[model samples]
Target: MSSVRKIVSTLVFAALTITSFQPALALSRVKDLVEVEGIRENMLVGYGLVTGLNGTGDSLKNAPFTQQTIQTMLERMGVNTRGQTMQTKNTAAVMVTAKLPAFASTGNNIDVSVSAMGDAKSLQGGTLLVTTLFGADGQIYALAQGPVAIGGFSAQGDAGSVTRGVPTAGRIPNGAIVEREIGFNLAAERSLKLSLRNPDLTTAARIASAVNTYVGSPVAVASDPATVRLAIPADYKGGVVGMLTDIEQVKVATDQSAKVVVNEATGVIVMGSDVRISTVAIAQGNLTIKVTETPEVSQPGPLSNGTTQTMPRTKIDIDEGKGKRMIVMKEGVSLQNLVDGLNALGVGPRDIISILQAIKAAGALQAEIQVIG
Candidate 1:
C-alpha cells in the first residue's frame, strides 16, 4: 500500500478497534439480487408509415416498395389503386417496435420506436399511422400510433446542408397499448423458487439455509447452484405475497465470480473486486501518425492568360514515444492498491488505459478487458 493510504487505513483500524460497533459491508437488495425465472420482456415489431413530412418523404420512383405498400393499404380499405403508379412526396415507410414487460396486461402503454425503412430523407414532424405490433408467434399484441418525436433536424441549401442527431428515427412515449397478457402463475405454485442472477454454489446454499432458518423448518432446498426452492407453509400457502415480502428483507451475502470488463472503444476498464494477478512486468508505448494536406495553385505560364489549376500536396509524420514503462504487480492485490501503484508514476487515465492493456497482453493483468464504443 502507498504510505498515505496505509496511514489512513491504520488510523481507521485503530478507531474501529476501540469503538463498540463497526460499520458492516453493504449488501444488495433481494429483489436486485435475484430474478424470477420464466418471466421476460416481450418483443413487438411491425411495419408502418410516417405522414406529415414536408417533402422529406421517400421518392416513389426509386422506392417501389413504399408505393406498393401504400397501394396494398389502400386496397385493404376497399379502394382499388392497382396498376396506378403513385408519386407520393408526403409519406415514409417505417418500422415500429416496442418491448412489453412481463405480466403486462391490457391497456398498458409502452414506448415505441419508429425508424424509417425507406430512403426517406427525414421523418421530422411526422406522425406514425396505426400499426399493429406482433410477436414471434405472429399474434398481434399491441397497437401503436402516435406523433413521432424526432430527435434531430435537417436543412439544405444550394451550397451545403446541415443536420443534427438522427432525423430518420423517432420515439413515441406510451405510444402502444397492450391487448394481451402472458400467463405466468407465480403465486399458485406449491413452493416458492428463487433464482439467483449470478448463481454460485456457496450463495445458493446460504440462501437456502437463511430461508429455512427464518421459517423454523427445513423447507428451503438448494436444488442447484443457480436455484433454491422453498416450500410454502400451510398458513402462507396461497398468500405468497406476504411470504415474499418477509423473505425479501432477509440479508444474505452473495459471492460473485472473478471477471474483468474492458471497453475497447472508449478505453475504459473495469475489474472485479475479487480479481487477482500473479507477479509480472509490463511495458507500454504510444505511437501517433499524422497526415496533412496543402492545396497549391499552378499557373499555366508566369503571366500568360491561361487557366490556373489546383494541385494537392500531402505530408506525413510519425511521433514515437520512449520505451514502455514496466510495472510489476503481485497477486491478490486490491483495486485501490493497483490504482495507487499506477498513479505513483503520474500516469493519467489515458496512459493507464494503454499500460493496463499491455499488462494484460503480457499475462500480468488477471482481469478481462472490454472495449466499449
Candidate 2:
C-alpha cells in the first residue's frame, strides 16, 4: 500500500511539472510569422476567346477588336471571313489570368480566371479556347483551355432583365497546364532569407533567438526589422531545405508596436494590446440648429376685392449639448481601460473616433493613430 501511494504521488508531480513547462498559447510558429524569400507565386495573363454564348456575346460592330480576332482565328482554320460580314453572337473576347505557384513543375494544372474584355452581357456556358498564358517576362509559361464555369446568368424579355452575380466573369478549375518551370534549387542554396510579414524589431530578434536555440548555434541573425539572414552551418545535414524545415517549426513570442486603427467609413476601431495613453481630459458634444417653415393663407374679408396671399413663417431652434461633461483619464491606461472609459461616455464609434483624434492632436495618446477609409 505504501509503495502504490508513492508511485501515484510521483506521477502527479511529473504531470504538474510538464504542464508548467508548456509553451504559452500566445507563441506562434516561425513559419506563420515569416515567409521564406524567393518562394512565391508568379502572375500569368493572356487574352482568349470564349465560344458558345447564347446571344449575349460582344457586338461585332461595337467591339472592332473582337471582329478582328475572330477573323484572324478563322483564317488560321482555312476559312476566309474578312471580306464577308460575319455577324456572330456566340463568341466573346476575354482576358485570362492565373497564378503559377512556387516550384510548379511542367504539366501541372492550375486554375484560371476569365473576364470579359469587351461588352459581353454573359459568359455562361462558354468554353475558352487555347490561350497561351505569359509571365511578366513576356514568355509563354502555361496553356489554358477549358469550359468556363460562371456563377450567374442573364435573361431578358421585351421590357426587363434580371441578373444574379457577375455573369461576365468566370473561373475554370485546373484549366491551365504549366509548360515551363521557374528554376529554383532550394537544396543547393548555401543561405536563405526570411521576411517578416509584419516588421517589428522585437519580433525579429525573438525569431532569431528561437532559430539559434533550435539549431544549438547562432545560425540565424536578425539583419533588420523586416529580414532575417540565416547561414548554413558546415555540419548541418540535409542542406538548406532540412535546416528550414527544422527552424520553421520553432515557436517564438512576437511583439508589436502599440497602434490604434480606425476606419471612418465603417466606424470600426481596432486597438493593439500594448496601446497606452497619457493623462488627458476629453469632452464630446454636438451643436445643431434646426429651422422649420410654415405657410399661412391670407384671405380677403367680407367678399372684398383683395386677393388671397400666402405668408411665410419660419421657426428656428438651437440645441447645444450642455449635459455632457469632461472625463479625465489617468496616465498609462491599458487598451481595456481605455475602451471602458470611452464606453462610459455613452458615445458611438464615430464619436469615439473624433475623440481619439482630438486626444492624439493634444499629444496625450501614446500609440500611433491610423485613420483608414
Error of 2 at 123 (Å): 0.7
Residue-level lDDT tens digits of model 2 in 285-362: 768799999989999898699999999999999888777677889999988988888887778999999988888999
What is the C-alpha local distance difference test score of candidate 1? 0.82
Number of the top-ranking candidate, with TM-score as the measure: 2
Candidates' lDDT values, in order?
Answer: 0.82, 0.93
**Model 2: per-residue Cα lDDT at residue 198:** 98
Candidate 1's residue-wise lDDT over 196-225, tens digit each?
A: 988888888888787778878898898999
Model 1: residue 7 alpha-carbon error in angstroms:
29
Clashing pairs in 1: 262-369, 262-370, 262-371, 263-370, 263-371, 263-372, 264-371, 264-372
Show the lowest summed lDDT stretch of 10 residues, model 2. 319-328
